[model samples]
Target chain A: MTSPIAGGVDCDLHPAVPHLTSLLPYMNDYWRDQVTTRGMTDLISQSYPVNSPISSRPDWRPVKGKPGSDIADLQRQALDRFGTAYGICNPLYGVQMVFSEDMANAFCRALNDWLAKEWLDKDERLRGSIVIPVQSIEKAVAEIERCAADKRFVQVLMLVMGDMPLGKRHYWPIYAAAERFGLPIGIHAGSAYHNPPTSVGWGSYHIEDYVAQAQAFQTQLTSLIVEGVFARHPNLKMVMLESGFTWLPPFLWRLHKFWRGVRMETPWVDRAPLEIVRSNIRFSLQPVDAPPESDTLNRLFDHMQSDELILFSTDYPHWQFDGDEVLPKGLSPDLVRKIMIDNPHATYPRLTVKEMTP
Target chain B: MNVQLRERPQAASSTGIKSAIADCDIHPARATKDELHPYLAKRWHGHIETFGVHAYQGMMEGPPYPKAQPNASRRDAYPPEGGPQGSSLSFMQKQHLDPNNVALGVLNPLNTGQGIRNQDLAAAICAAINDWQIEKWTSKDARLKGSVVVANEDGVSAAAEIRKRAGDKNFVQVLLLSRNVEPLGQRRYWPIYEAAQEAGLPIGVHAFGFGGNPITASGWPSYYIEEMVGHSQCQQTALASLVLEGVFERFPKLKMVMVEAGFGWAPSLAWRLDKVFSKLHGEVPHLKRKPSEYIRDHIWWTTQPMEDPESRDHLFQVIEWIGWDKLLFATDYPHWDYDEPSRVLPAGVSDANRQAFYLDNAKQLYGIS
Candidate 1:
């Protein structure tokens, strides 16, 4: 009977919107009428199919309603159970999938409001991520501008696999806005399904889509670095949530190798990709993909070179681990403190500011 | 330009490989653009002259992500006799094969018509390239073996070509690009796998192809580095598709070797698949075994641009998870990201593992012995 670690900051907690209709009170009157008149039901992203074991831990799951819908459950299971000092709410509603730009923006606004009022307001330990409708760059920036003033919003949220790679110049405005407010852009796994989940084409099994998330994260990481996103936004930090980090060492080796060989094409990339990653990129700690043995996990950590890269997270109700074994076995007590507290504080400046405020 | 593989120490040391060595990936290029023209029919000659192959990438003449260096080859690799890297057989032997003591080298020729949109043209070009590999490579050197390049999009035709080359010593395996119009596991590609199984040849899915899809799950990336890194991701999707589509169950005898793309992700990829499989096995009732079991049995990977982690043993851990025998040594010779024989396998590898990784595995997989 081991004790759970206390005072850790949980970086990724998915607070599910109970149903599409629940956002009605938060939505503008015009959009509320539009949603009801259109007869919209659930907009759950297939990425997290309800009832999939990975969608929610069997033990934490409720008898009814959505897996991550209840604030009380999140507070007890995710916050108190793990002794988390703060838990960031990254609502995984299918607002990113809405085809209509107008619909996506409206829903994104409503989702942000719902997150603040229902979840953040309920728990002082909870923080919010601004879920931007990324279909239109201008609107995405506008949403960021609207949400940035709310000090409770700690990060800007986007899906890992969107219609375009996240690094395109068009999307820089949103990054710029987020940067202005010291908000790190958190890229979570799952796609818009605007394209096939896999690079080649769609796969038959749900597991195939799940496996492809790591690959999608790698592509976006490459996109972010090689497309000069890191170079352009020198101080901006990008957090990859639910993105596995075991593949990082080799990925950096391969990317750094090519960047050296072909520096002429993208001359703006003045420093090594690995250096850039160490500086600007932060990865969530969950879904440890290395073999379960702590020795194997530690060896991968050795490969990671920097201990500061990983921040702790339960990936709440996501069934990434069995019980309270959210932190993999191998980490040292010092590393545990950094992963759970220091790293998350460093990556998310708002957490530090809020902690300092009171 | 500053590659040290060309100048890496050649002396056989205590740690050096003592037995036979096999390089599973050696990309042989064309000296000239019309090198395979003579192998093609006169009908294709005019089509080639006028209607060029339609590719999925935006650019018709060059790759979507422009390669960092010309031909994406090592600076030292271009033959003094004046042709592209790997274009001259003698240069390969002098620079890589003989020096590295490669006893068996498999030729994987790229920039072929195998992936083009026109099925007829792709078929003709594939056959021509197949014939050309025999005349220009295998016939000239017994150390090398050829891969039967096929029009992978046209499954029936790809199978026919495999059957045509079946049991032929000139070719040791069938070659399919990682990226295709549809995931290779689709019924569209089963014919090729079936024929390869019948032929007793492993199908090598080297990482490069375009099926009109973006190089990434998102869309076209900005740099060649992304494409290079994207190779492993593309192969991951390929393996996932093949596993979940029950390609292994349908033709259990068909073996696959993922070439060029690093194999570090295999164990984790399989682990995730198996983890999910335990819950969602009902979705794929056709599968008799777990996804890892299928992967462990049927899939093999070649080492090139090998994972150079901070701790060398970290790679060994992945190799341990992905069984030692499943890895075949590859140099990806003449390419800029070539993995030299001595340099790739980090220190502390046991003799038995090294023997299997460098020689025994490829020999058994390709039946070279």
Candidate 2:
């Protein structure tokens, strides 16, 4: 496999929060007191099973701490090894799992502050996604507004499977806020477990759980398009993080075919679903979930006419791919460059500004 | 098998006459619930009038996401004679079978009550549907064939139903729903498979059933669009369950056909299953082969709402991954998105592959001569 060129932007890198106590310092006095008094330090890991082979790459795991907790280790393994000039840190924690809107908001605030201070502040190459409390739209929008002030926070992170379909009007404020600040909404592959991952119910093993992520992404994409999220917020960008890309071409095809037949129902969706997906939705590269054969990837790329849809993501500490195999083998050099750097720059307005600056 | 079946494609292509097509998924619904009343037992006829259907799903009218049209079908598909879409054999012949040059059309009548909770009721309704198809459709048109509908929830009865229709040439395959009480591979459903294999019939699994579970893992999807696209996901789970649980290993001769659920995901699903099964083979010790091997050897996919990739070449690649011989043509007749046989395949397909996809594949699988 060919190594990615230097100066590429890593769109998805998980910054681990070791323990609940770690974020306690970042919380406000009232929230800090509430945590101490309530003894609410045991935050559950939302999607990641700590010991899964996929949660941490064998090489990236630290000798002492949780795999992604150490900043120096991440820099050495992800940034230095892949030659990623800019890496976006998406902190996945159990903040979205909290039921109370107030508590969820408090945890989200602490999570963002901790991310900004521990990861983004320590490394110039590091950028972050503002972790928001998606349980309540008002608080999510407020959180987005609060974090948008810092250009280092390039995107807003929402779990792919949430309480309601992400396209409903209740969630429009969050999309509107992200669009206003020119920030893309990053829907990462994690679930709140509000419902079973499959419509039939939960699967028996992790493989079923892991495989179901692609299906979840499909549901969200269709929901967003049909609910008129794109038509309403024309300038918004939806980046599907760690969601496999190969399944998309077929899903879009099915979507478009049905759209042609049922366009009368969703009248606002004027164009074909494929056209809308190309213009609005984007997918991350790693966990390619495709046949390793070069011809398969080539045909997939051919199906995905636009090269800009895929942004380079190592998904650091996540064992999606092995060694320098971050970029799938068959891509041409031009396509590689576009995925690693050009696509990220185009997707995130903040990244463009960073590149232009001295 | 008929020698003319292979030559028919070439002859039809060369002549102005439409090419011979074998539609593996043509839905034929009842004009009214009362139509099945004659075939149903006296008890069921009274039950239908009173309580109505008590399916596994929350609502009996249909899926939560109301179809684009009244039966979730194309508006124009409603017959000129004024019955619900797909209810009239004469209308189907004029609009779909005859116009499309469908040499053999396999009827998958879903309204036969597969999802109903009461096994006896579901079985009774399934039997009535079979008798109804013979009287209304297969008997009326020599070109039309039927799928033996069964209450998959109760395998004993389902096997019996399969056996009852096995000798009849009009019934080609045993039809089951994608959504069921349990994953199809489990021992509960094995009897149905045994009956099918013994009878030398392929099991045709059409999408849409009330499996006593939400349409999605995340709960009922809010929109019709999400529910529609989800048809393939259900099939993916079923195929994985069938392979991993060793259904193919136990019943080697059993042929399975996935109809209506698009074929695009088959390649990815097989790859994912094989990739995981390689490392986790211990979980399913009964399997002797890779998941893809069983899928390739046993399972056949029908192409309707056939994947239309942005690049036509991409769809060709998908077709290649899913071998031409394993693919059977289906139009999902009278549904909102029926693919016209002539227009479905893109330019890159070779004449031989095209002939096999439209006719020969289904003929060999169903033993149609």
Candidate 3:
């Protein structure tokens, strides 16, 4: 059933990178010259090919450029349409795609700046995700430090699929920065393409690649849990953007089951996997990946054991749900409130900016 | 038989429902140490001593994340005779097979060299494992049946092994690990599927096989829990590869029983595959039917590492979506996360569904009279 109410917070809305030229203004002199000299084209991701149905809803697509590129369209279709009190702009630009560490850092800086200038700065209601070069922890931490000053930048963003599992100690510096800055780590669906999209091998179709993304998130989530990411950085929250929520309950159950038998390996995991997930993980509600029956979806909610786990999202311009029915059918009124507003506020403490006295 | 069926023996099941049932996923280690070495040619032994088994990873000790328990087996399962937990027949019967009333138990022998990169060595070890299964365990135990363990990466050798074991009453299916060199559906692995179909034996892809790559697509995880949960994730990829790449269409009669991987993910994975296939059917035009249809027509799943969702009904919903007949009951005996058949299924299951889940499905799938 569609939510009868408004005033929700859309946690995951993509503001597309129009083309390489748009990022030039944000890039430094050396990178700008390199881009012009190399004559690079747009860096749209393969996971969300521009023409694919999954990339953007039919009406939400911008006629001139990429979907979510035009701020006016996103405002009309997403914010105003849903009466979103606050919306987080998770830029799905290819900032983490470059092989060179310096190039990745440059692109990430440009992406964050572009999100701030083009999206966040334009709308008081919209917030930005700080895209970081995940390959280099030093650069990633530096980027987090640079962007945390904006307060408008609420979360540090990285791809679900990257060079290694996000839980490894190598990536802990980024998480440490996020925890220190009171910014959650927003892990969005998409990959750095360093490895095959799947553990077995590369699949033939885009659908295979897209569907396989959930598996990537599962692996990464497990890595985070087993690797003691949460145990070490206890205060941090990791938001799964566009990585569906319905799968979380079972995924946690599986981990909890195995963790019992293998608890000795990671002694830092002092609590149950379920408890850790409750304490740290939050999923943005979109692409529900659920059966249509309200009762069935409701049963899944029951299995999840908490209403506060999901923050609301239209996954705007991503063709997740048509029209406004961004909220799935089964949520009760109280549950909707938790998902739409309370959950987001609780997950991203930085969502509410305080006034400076100076 | 009817009177005995009506009786409720406490030891027969952890829950109340008690009757002799078929267990689809029992792992039986060798009866004695070095039992398989006799089956292997002497030259391989010298090669093994000189170079050792080249594991997929750098470590020779085994998985990077060690199990909480020794060999990831039940502490009580170790035999008094000083072998591994599953390495003794009488001990297994005493602990699990007899007490649980496991009428017909299928043996899944893991930790073979099927996952090694050296194809010739993998094939030799696989052949030795096949011989060891018969001469050691299945030959002595009438209730036990063997799986034709194959070098999953070397399809040609695997198929040849399957053909060699064709119509052997002791052997019921061919075994492959969920994690392989590539998705099992690729043409490289088609030969094994074809041979299994020709032999009229189901191919059982059990979770936790020979590990080749970092179990996760991105890389190795921090803990063994990631590897454990990764079993289902890898199987999803295997099922998708099999359906999308026309494994089912090409080998129409081939039957696949996904053992040890939890069954909860089947409905959702198939649904996701169907949704994507509808939009991107052109990419895989070779598919003769929807991915879900192929899944319904071909695949069978075993219930091990049974999902304990917050609500029992969620598992019921998954089963209802997958179908009543599609699930084969398994007790991952001697393993750390073993599911007791009596206690695993949620309470209030109908007798007919229980019959299908515990006994009828596996009996029919394996062609057991």
Interface RMSD of each: 1.6, 2.1, 1.7
What pairs collide in candidate 3?
A: A1-A329
TM-score of each: 0.94, 0.90, 0.93
lDDT of 2 by residue, A250-356 (tens): 88888887777667778998667787888888888877877788877787788777898999999999887777888888789999999998888889889745542
Q: After superposition, how far is residue B57 of candidate 1 from its true place, in Å?
A: 2.4
lDDT of 3: 0.83
Whole-model lDDT, model 2: 0.83
Q: Tell me how many residue pairs clash in candidate 3.
A: 1
Interface RMS for model 3: 1.7
RMSD of each: 3.0, 4.9, 4.1
Residue B70 CA error for candidate 2 (Å)?
Answer: 3.9
Residue range B1-369, candidate 2, lDDT tens digits: 111233333223323488889999999988876888789888877788888888886775766678876786777678877889999888887777776788899999887769899888989989999999899999999889999999888989999999998889889999998888776666788999999999998999988887776666555666777788877887788777788778898999999999889999888778777765655576567889988899999989999878876678777778889898999999988886778777888887789999999999999888888
User: Between the candidate structures 1 and 3, which one is better when assessed by TM-score?
Assistant: 1
Candidate 1 residue spans exceeding 4 A from truth:
A1-3, A352-358, B2-20, B80-82
